[model samples]
Target: MGIADLLSDVWGTFSHPAPDAEAPPTGGSSTSSPAAESGAEKEENKKDAKSDDGGEQGHRPSEGGDEEEEEEEETVDPKDTLEDECKESKECQPAKHHYDECVDRVTGQIDNDGKASEDCIEEFFHLAHCATQCAAPKLFAQLK
Candidate 1:
């Protein structure tokens, strides 16, 4: 019937469901792929740019055994990653509603407290957790 039905049927067929039944969902991208491909593509573009400038069409510098550099990869921020993922959704009201509620709640409070309410922050974070991390980096980079 639907994807959920198909997933349920396939999962049901497996006798041993494994020990970690409460594992988080793996959105849909391999951890190494986008990073690797992006590096390769970036190199390709750089080479192309150099040649297009009428300079000697020289051999592109090889990424020779750059394993160590890769190992020293920097960590990305979780909030930034979540923001990136949220941008890709076709439609999402949670963030907007959360923001509006925060504004409304603060404005209506009239307590002279110059702070947004906790309920708004909680709702926003809850909605954010549901966002997939697959396209986060790309989305964040583009926005920047």
Candidate 2:
């Protein structure tokens, strides 16, 4: 079987089946998790806090919690982050090119011979070393 078929079979075996649309709803309490109940309670507490005075919900004005909340909400996609970081590291371009070429060569060999005679370890290591050297300072600076 193809990869997609294999994956689908594996998924079918492990995944829970979805409930039928026409099925009757279970009791209301069956659906809400403990975490969800806690979140709802927190929302009610926040509302109560807001009603106490004309102030922010869940945090006092002087606590500066808004900045932390905003930071937590702003998520960066890992794939895009990696691509952006690598694109900025110009010094690593030559090594990256060499690695790409090596990968292509090996892929072509595999296609023709069902296996590659040589792996791209050397090229991969060279590229990784270059990227690390270029990225470390920038990453550390960001952390600070």
Candidate 3:
């Protein structure tokens, strides 16, 4: 399965509590008869049942939380993060300059047209590849 699917499954499992484990019972009479004990247990079970139902209902997000999270992940630009990293390194100045210029040019083009052209996309990728090549040798080697 994809990362999105895996994350959704994990989120669902964590958000809901286990069915079998219920909260411990509160104060009860110490000298209760067998019938009274059973009845009391049933009453407690009923109260617990309502609470458990409410918990499950309350935990569910009104919006599609999983989908929103996946969308956020998709929208994140790796190049932005890499550019920031490059800015922090003196050795990566040349790469950082190229990356910043590429981003600026591509962003302006997309902003004007409302969508990226194939040529713009190709050029952005090529500039990004060059920036990667120009990055600090130790850091770039670790990325491989």
Candidate 4:
């Protein structure tokens, strides 16, 4: 897949709520408003309030669970993973070399000029894209 698609997938995975999660209400009247007056209505309101409060408390633990899962999922540093793949794959060598050269050149330019020019920034992105393309297969494999 293209880098855009891969990035979109990653973002989607992080941004989308869990399948079982109940989305919070977007717009609603306050539950505390003076609406329930009858005895049965007051009892039902109490039950609803208890359930809502319980649901919120229950949801906190699941958030902690998700954090643990995320930690497990991101055990490897992506840059190190890509470098390892680049080292193993001969096809990726040229792109890796170009990327390194670009980085070195940009570094030298920044050191000499005290800032990055537009062209240098553009070249950096180009080299980055090349490196990403070279590492795509192995990176995707690692992600899976």
Winner by TM-score: 2
User: Mind giving the per-residue lDDT tens digits that candidate 3 earns over 1-144?
Assistant: 999999999998999988977889998855345555566566665666677964642233437456565434466555566655655567555655666677787778889998765344555565556556545464655568
lDDT of 1 by residue, 95-131 (tens): 5566667767877765667654545666666556545
**Residues 1-144 of candidate 4: C-alpha lDDT, one tens digit per residue:** 999999999999899888998978796755566672567656676766677864542212434455554444546678666856655567656655666677787778889999765344555465566556767777778779
Candidate 4 error regions (>4 Å): 1-88, 116-144
TM-score of each: 0.26, 0.43, 0.27, 0.32
The order by descending TM-score is 2, 4, 3, 1
Write down the lDDT of every candidate, Cα atoms only.
0.62, 0.72, 0.62, 0.66
Winner on TM-score (2 vs 3): 2
Candidate 2: where is the Cα deviation over 4 Å?
1-84
Report the lDDT of model 2 for residue 21.
36
Which structure is stronger by lDDT: 3 or 4?
4
| Segments in model 1 whose C-alpha atoms lie over 4 Å from true places | 1-89, 110-118, 132-144
Specify the highest-lDDT model's number. Answer: 2
For candidate 2, what is the total of clashing residue pairs? Answer: 0
In model 1, what lDDT does residue 28 have? 75
Model 2, residue 23: C-alpha shift (Å): 44
lDDT pick, better of 2 and 4: 2
Model 2 C-alpha lDDT per residue in residues 7-117, reported as the tens digit of each score: 999998679556653777766653235555477567666666668875544533537556554445777755446545774578778888888899999999999999999
